[model samples]
Structures are given as C-alpha cells and as structure tokens.
Target chain A: MDVAIIKYNAGNIRSVDHALKRLGVSAEITDDPDRIKAAERVIFPGVGEAVSTMAYLRERELDKLIAGLTQPVLGICLGQQLMCQWSEEGDTSCIGIFDQPVKQFPAHELKVPHMGWNSLDRLSGELFPESLLGSYVYFVHSYYVPECEDSAAVCNYIVPFSAAMQKGNFYATQFHPEKSGGPGQEILSNFLKL
Target chain B: MLAKRIIPCLDIRNGMTVKGINFENVVDVGDPVELGAKYAQEGADELVYLDITATHEGRKLFADLVGRIAEHLNIPFTVGGGINHVSDAGILLSAGADKVSINSSAVRDPDLLDRIAGGFGNQFVVVAIDAQFKDEKWTVFVNGGRIPTDKELFSWAHEAQERGAGEILFTSMNHDGTKDGYACEALKTLSEKLSIPVIASGGAGKEDHFVEVFQEGKADAALAASIFHYNEIPIPELKSYLKQNHINIR
Candidate 1:
C-alpha cells in the first residue's frame, strides 16, 4: 500500500517512518498535499508544543488539508492533540477533526507527562483489537483529552482520559504507538490493515 | 495504571556496547543494536545508551548506531554522554533517539537544558545528575562522578525542573556499583521534591533490589547496567517478581 506520513515542523517523524518500515510498509514522509491525498493511508505524527504547531500548520494550509482527508488517517501524540477542537497549550484552536478539547494534566501528586508504560481500558473502535484490552502502551505527554462519546480507549493517571479516539475516517492516539513495544506494533499493524 | 519502568543502560565506547556484555546465546555481543533488541524482547521498558567516546568520528558512529537501534527496536531509548549543546541533542533526536540526556554539560551550562527544552520541547530533554554523599551532605558531581560540584542534590534537581527538564535521572554515586541496593531514602526525597518523573540509576544488584527501588524508593523507573548485561538478574524474572510483590509493572 502507498502510505504517506504528513511531515511538518514536528519531532519524531523519523521514528514513525521507521515504525512503518518495521511493519513492512515503506511510507513516504512528505509535505506535498497532492501526494498525501493520493496515498492509501496517511499518518499525522508529531512531538512538539500544540500552539506553535497549530500556527505552523495553518501557515502552510496543511491544517485544512488534514481535516478534509477521508482515508484511514491516523494521528499520534501531538498530531492527535492538533486534531481536537482546541488545546489548552498556549490556548490555541486546532483543526477540529475530533469533537474534543485538549487540556493539560491536573497538577497533583502524579507526574506531569505521565511517561512510561500505561495500560488502556475500554478498548473500542477498529484501531484496537480485543487483544489490546488492558495491554500497556507507551505514553509521554502532559496534555490529554477527556473521555467522551468518541473515546476508543481510556487510561487513568490523575484522571481517566482518552487514550484513543475514532470518528469517521479519522483515528488518533495520544500515546506513541511507534515506541510502545509489541502491543504498540500490533496497533500500527491494525491501522495498516484498516 | 502507569507501570514502573525497567531500563537497561548500555555503555557505548567507539560506537560499540562495552563493559563486557556476558549474555549467552547472543551473537555480536558488542553490537548495540543486537544487545538492545534482546533486552527489548526480554520485557525491558526502555533503554539508555551512554556514549563515552570523545572523538568527533566516534560521535558520528554513535549517531549511526542510534539510527540502527531505532530501526530494530520498538521501545523508546535515550542517548547521553557528551551532549554539550542543543545541536548535539538535535543530531541524536533526529537519528531517532526518543530523548537526549545531558549530564556534566548541563552542570557546566545550566542554560543548555533550557535551550534544548525550548527548541525541542521539555519532553525531549532528560537531566541526569550524579551526586555523592560526603561530609553529611549530598553534593552533585560531574564528568562521570570524577569531579564534585558545589551544587547540592535536591536544589540542583529542582533547578533543572524549573529550567524545563521533563525527567530527572539521579545516580547516587555513593550507592552506585555497590550492588547492595538503591538509595531509597534519597530517591524518596527526590520523588517528593520534584513533580517530574525520577529515574533511579546506579545501584541494582538483585531482583529484590529492584523491588526496593520501586516500592521503597518510589522511583518512576530503575536503571542498571552490570546486573542486566551479565544476566545476573534476568528482566522477565525480575518483572514477575515485581508483579508478585504487588508493584505495578509492565
């Protein structure tokens, strides 16, 4: 399958490309809108601040292009946050692909980023199979989307939040599937199959 | 639940895994990618590669090795050793290192932390502090625990956090290489003082030592080298032991 990973001013895009290569798929990392629209699959992966990232996306007109994608589009980490309606990080508005808002994890006894391996609960949608239920996936983020009607999975840190979400052709995960080990590999394979 | 992480640290010299990896049934033991893949298969949560090479060519070799490791392993990994500037960290991160750890360089120039965290987000930076207990006070040491700095342990760690460090990798020089146990008292104090995750390094002797580090130390993660590299304490057995001990483990 011809897969294209939308590249921008984001981090870890190389890691995501390596992950796809590990799964026997050579995905093109491109910023060209035509190639992104022509690919069979599109992956929006990033690791950066949300506000500045949104601004960059808008300046390049990639934000609208991403929201209009009708294929099996997957967003990872910061990519997922930018798909939401708005983000608390710098109080910036997002692409509005998912009817959710991103907010920072409340300051409490727990750590801010919620780093390391954390298990997912309430596995739903096509991105996660039954085998992924209660399986630990790697996570490294301070901001998260609250559990809602579109939540595909939930994870508890200081509070229960959306670990994965799916709506129409768009699917997203706050955790890094490329770095989540075996269970994470399975997730990427599932997305490829979709 | 967020599981406690088990990280196996590998020392890289001239772009090869060093300190004599003694794992049996392994080909090319000196190869970082091969050894790191094996650890990941054994249920290691993450890996740390400390590049001890000093030459410019050796740093380039280490970056190539980082890309090779990223292509082979699925879990996250951090690279450290001679990162003195933001561009140095940038090279490793672009080479597919999930995070770049700064040690002595960060001590010499604390702004290195801010520059890195600002350029690549705080989550991409790990501030590693090596401290030794002396004169009834814990003092920070730099240059691989060779030189002692005037900075205290708690205050320096707090400063790193304020400068936008995502995590703190604390290596108690006194407890390091002792094989008795981790500095639980110091680790608990660090965990309580900082809101970011604390990764305890240095002392890891046995399976029970891992338990003590996680349970009593309240560390977010535990890192060790010899015990894991030599197969003295296998990761699967240690993880199951932690599970039986009612500790949250992956």
Candidate 2:
C-alpha cells in the first residue's frame, strides 16, 4: 500500500518512515499536496509548535488539501491537534476536520506536559481492533483534543482527553504509534490494512 | 482517570547493560534489547536508556543498540547521555527514541533546548537534571554527576520549562542506587514547583518505593535500574502492587 507521510517543518518523520519500512511497506514523506492526495493512505506526523506547524502547512496550501483528501489520513501528535477546528497553543484556527478544539492542559498543580507511556481507556470506533482495548501506547503532548463525536479512545492526565479520533476518512492519534512498542505496531499495521 | 506509568531504566556502557551502586562498582547486566523486550512484555509503561560511556566510539555503539531495540520491541523509548547538539537529538529521535533527554549540554547552552524544542517539539525534549544536596541546597550536576553547577535546582527547572522542555527527569545523585527509596522530599518539592511532569529517578529498590514516589512525592513516573535488572522487582508484579495500592497502572 502507498502510504504518504505529510512532511512539514517537524521531527519524528524519519522514525515513522523507518517504521513503515520495517513493516515491509514503502512510504513517502513529502509536503506536496498532489503526492499526498495520490496515496492510498496518508500519515500526518509532526513534533513541533502548533501555530508554526499550522503556518507551514498553510504556506504550502497543504492545509486545505489535507482537509479535502478522500483517503484515510492519520495525524500523529501535533498533526492530530491541527486537524481539529482550533488550538489555544498559538490562538490558531485549524482545519476544522473534527468539531473539538485543542486546548492546553490546565496549568494546575498537575503537570502541563503529560509525557511517557499511558494506556488507552474507554475505546470506541471500528478502526481499533478488539485486542487494542486497554492497550498501552506512548504519548507526549501538551495540548489534547477533548472527547467529542469522533473520539476513538480516551486518556487522562490531570484530566481526561481524546487520545485517538476517527472522523470520516481522517484518523488521528495523539500518541506516537511509531515510537510505541508492540501494541503501537499493531495500531500501525491496522491502519496500513485499512 | 490518568493511568500510572512503570518505567525501566537501562544503563549502557560500551554497548552493554550495566548496573552499579552510587553510580560506581559497575556490573554487567545483559543485552539491552533482551532486557528492554522483557520489560515491555512484563508490562513496563516505558523504557529509558542511559549511555554512561563518554567516548565517541561508545556513542556510535549506543545508537546502534537503540536502533536494534527499536526494531525488536514496540514500545516508547527515551535515550540520553552525550547528547549535546541538535544533530545528536535528530540522530537519536530518528533511530526510534520517543524523547531525547539533555543535561549538561542544555545547561551550557540554554538555546540548545530552544533549538531542539523548536525542531522536535517540546514534547520530545526531556531535560534530565542530576541534582545533589549540598549545604542544605539542591545543586544541579553535569558530566554524569561529576561536575556541580552553582545554579539552584528550582531555578534551573523553571528555566528548562521556559525553554520549552516537555518534562524534567530529576535524578537525585545523593540517593541514586542507594536503594533507600526515592528522594521524596526533593521530588515532592520539584513536582509541586514545576508545571511539567517530573520523573523521579534513582534509588528505587522495591515496589512500595514506586508507590511512595507517586503518592508522597507526586512524581508522574518512577524510574529504576538495578531492581529491574536483577529481577528483584518484576515490572508486572510492581504494576500489580501499584494497582492494589489504588494507583493507576496499565
């Protein structure tokens, strides 16, 4: 299957690329909209500031192109947040693909940036396999998408938030599947098969 | 509710897993990939690899080992030691590290933290602080606990956060490998002070120690090396105990 990983000014793209190579699938990492639209599957992965990242996507007009794609597009970490309607990080407007808004973790006594590995809970949606219920995945995020109509799984840190979401052809996860071990690979494999 | 985390730390020297007390009296553990996979299967929430070797040759080996482990296991991994440049961060993250931790390098150039956070996102940048108690004050240490910085712990931690560090991995050099328990007092102070998650490392010997760090210290995660390497406390058993103690674990 042809998997296109949208590449803007971000990190973790190479790791995701290597992961797909390990799965015996050749994937392309590009910022070009036409190449992304041509792929059977799309992987939107980012590790950077939300506003600047969104700006980079907008600069190339990949923002609208992404929203318009009919293929199954998967957004990871910051990519997932940008797929939402808006984000508070940079007071930025997003793709509005999902109805939820990405908000920063409450700067209370609890930690603002929830790093490390945590398990998925209260999973829903057909994209996830039965074996994936209650499975642990690696997550590193400061802002999260609150539980909304598209939530596939939820994770809590100070407060609960959507860890994974699936709305129409777009499937996004706040967790890094490429970095997450076994269960993570399973999720990636599922996405590939889809 | 938020699920609690269990992390296994592997100390690598010359491409081999090593464990020691007080960061000395080192003893070889085993292969990193084997141990890492074991922890993953045993229900470890995450794995941290610290390369203790200081030579250029050792770094190449560490990178190779990280790649081997990443290919073998499906879990989140953090890599640290001898990381001073954005290229180093890029190398490790590309090799499958979920996060690249900076210590002495970040202290030398705070802008390095900003550069990394800008390049890799703050979420992937972890600032590891090795603090020692001296003159009734917590002092930050560099060069693998060899050099002490005059800067106070609280201020350094705040600077790290302001520079966009995602989390702070605090290791009390005074309590490391002592097996007495975590430096709860220090951890609690930092945990309460910082807005980012604090991972309490060093001196975890028993399962209850994990509970103590979370309950009393308010640490987001607890990291240990010897206990896990020697099989003194299995990851699954530790998780079970944490669960029984009403702590979240998966």
Candidate 3:
C-alpha cells in the first residue's frame, strides 16, 4: 500500500514515519502534491505554530491540495488544528475541511498546553475502534477545537473538547497517535487499514 | 481527566545508559533505547534522557542514540544536557525527540528559553531546575548540582513560566538518591504557583513515594533514575500501586 506523509514546516514528522515503520508500513514523507494525491493513504502530521505553517502550506499551494484530498487523510496534532476553519493562534485562517473553529485553551487554574495522557471519551468513527473507547492518548497543544457534531472522540481537561474529529474522508486527531504508545499504534494501524 | 505521568529518566554517557548517584558516581546500566522500549511496554507514560557526555564526539553519539531511540520507542520522550543554544534544541527535536529540556544554560541566559520556544512552539521547551535547601531557602545549583547560584527556587520557576517555558522539572539535591521521598512541600508550592506543569525528580524509592509526589506534592509528573534503572521498583508494580492508592495514573 502506498502511504504518503505530507511534509511542511512543522516538526516531528519523522516520529509519525517511525510509528508506521513499527507497524511494517514504510511511508514516504514528501511535500510533492502528485505523490500525496496518488497515494492510497495520506497523513498530515505536524508540531509547530499555526500561522507560519499555514503560510508555508499556502506558499506551495499545499493547503488546497490537502483540503481537496478525496482519499483517506489523517491529521495529527497541529495538522488537526489546521484542518479547522480558523485558529486563534496568530489569528490565522486554515483549510476548511471541518466546519469548526480552533481556539486557545482559556487561562485558568489548569495548565494551558493540556500535556500528557488523557482518556478518549465518546469514541466514534473508523479511526477509533470500539475497544479504544476509554483508551489513553498523548496530547500536547495549547489550542483546541471544542466538541462538536463531527467529533469522533471527546477528552475533557479544562473543558470537553474534540480529541478526534472526522467528516467525509478527512479524519483528524488533536492527540499524537504516533506517540500515544500501544493504543496510538492501534490508531495508526486502523488508519492504514482504512 | 489527565492522568499523572510516570517518567523513567535515563542518564546517557557515551551513548550508554548510566545511573547517577547524586550527580557524582555513575554506574553503567545497559543500552538506552532497549531500556526505554522496555519501560514503554511496562506502562511508562513518558521517558527522559539526560546526556551527561562532555566530549564533542560523545554529544554527536548522543544525538545518534536519540534518533535510534525514536525509531524504537513509541512513547514521547525528552532530551536534556549541554543544550546551550536554540540550534542545539533544534538538532535534538529534529532528530525525533518530543521535547528538549534546558537546565544550567537556561539559568545562564534566561532568554534561551524564549528563543527556543519561539522557534519551536512553547510546548517544545522544558526548563529543568536543580536546587538544594539551605539557610531557610532552596538555592539553585548548576554544573550537575556542584555549583550553587543565587536564584531561589520559587522565583526562578515563576520567571521560567513567564519566559515561555512549557513545563518545569525540579530535582531536589537533598532528597535525590536518599530513597526516602520527594520534596513534597516544595513541589506543592511550585505546582500551585505555576500554571505550567511541574515534573518532580530526584527522590523516588518505593511505590508510596510515587503516590506522595502526585497526591501530596501535586506534581503533574514524577521522574526517577536508580530505582527504575536498578529494577528496585518496576514500572508496572508502581503504577498499579498508585492506582490502588486512588491516584490518576497512566
């Protein structure tokens, strides 16, 4: 199976590729639109600023290429945030795959980034199996998309938010499945089988 | 609910895992990547690798080891030691480390935190502080806790948070390697004062110590070296013990 991991200005893309390798899938990390479009599975993984990454995507027209992908596409961490309509980070506009807005976690008594392991609540969609309903996944982000109609899973910290969201062939996760340990590997395997 | 993280810290010297006795005596254990992979399978929430190598070649070897560890381990890990510049952090994170921790260098030039955090998001930077209690105060230490500075514990931690630190890893020189417990009172104060997460290190002996650090100390994460490296307290047993004690563990 041909799997292409879309490359951009974000960091830690190698970790995702390494995760797939552990599952016996060697994916090509590329920024070329043709390879991304021709692959059976495409993964958009990132860890960086929203505005600068969005600018890099637009500079190479990868934004439109990613939004129009008809095949099964999985976005991880910042990739998931960029899939939303807009983001509060630097007041940037993102690819409108999911009709949701991303906002920064309000400063309160709780920590801002919401880092570490958290259970995935209300699991739905193909990316998350029924067995993974209450499974723990790794998360490290200051901005989050609130739980909405398209939410595949919800995780509560400061408030209930979408741990994973899906619409059409586009699937996204706010957590890093590549770094969530065994359950994370299961999630990446599910995406491969999709 | 966010689960309390149990981190197994590995000290890397010349690409080999070693257990530091109060940052002085070093005992070679085994390969770091293999030990890390085993810890991950044993339910360790995360891993922290501190590079203690001094030579240039040793540093390069550590970076190579980091890449190998990333290839094998599935869980998130942080790398620290001798990180003086933002480019040093970039090298580690680009090599597949989830986070880069800054210690004495951050204290030397406080703005290093801001530059690294600016270059690679706030979540990428972790400020590690080592301090020892004396004269009714906890004074910060550098150069592997051999040199003491004028920076106080609480004030420096707050300043690090304000300067874009995502988390703070505090190691008590007094409690480290004692096998008694963590600095719970100080940890509680640090946790309450900062909005970012606090990782407690230095003193972890038994399962009860883990419980105390999380519940009483209010730390977001707990890190231990000798107990885990020497197999005195297995990761699985400790986690189950914490769970039985009514602590939220991962």
Among all candidates shown, the one with the greatest TM-score: 3
Give the local distance difference test score of model 2. Answer: 0.85
Q: Model 1 misses residue B204 by how many Å? A: 1.0
lDDT of 1 at A161: 95
lDDT tens per residue, model 3, B1-250: 8999999999999999987665567888889999999999999999999999999999999999999999999999999999999899999988999999999999999999989998988898899999999999999999999999989999999999999999999999999879899999999999999999999998898899999998899999999888888899999999889889999877
Question: What do the candidate models score in CA lDDT, each in turn?
Answer: 0.91, 0.85, 0.93
Q: Native-vs-model 3 lDDT? A: 0.93
Q: Which tens-of-lDDT digit does each residue in A1-194 have in candidate 2?
A: 88898988886577787678768898998877778889999999987787888888888998999999998889998889999999999899998899889998876655667766677877876667767877877777778899877899988777788999998888999998887777777888888888
Which segments of model 3 are wrong by more than 4 Å? B23-25
- Itemize residue pairs with steric clashes in candidate 3: none
Chain B TM-score of all predictions, in order? 0.96, 0.95, 0.98
Rank by lDDT, descending? Answer: 3, 1, 2
Give the residue spans of candidate 2 off by over 4 A: A18-24, A32-34, A118-122, A129-133, A156-160, B21-28
Choose 1 or 2, whichever is better by DockQ: 1
lDDT by residue (tens digit), candidate 1, A13-50: 99898999999999999999999999999999989998
- Ten residues in sequence with the least summed lDDT for candidate 1 chain B: B20-29
Residue B221, candidate 3: how far off, in angstroms?
0.4
Q: Give per-residue CA lDDT, model 3, range A1-194, as digits (tens).
A: 89999998898899999999999999999999999999999999989989899999999999999999999999999999999999999999999999999999998898888999999989899888789988999999999999999999999989899999999999999999999998999999998998
Which DockQ values do the candidates obtain, in the order shown? 0.91, 0.54, 0.91
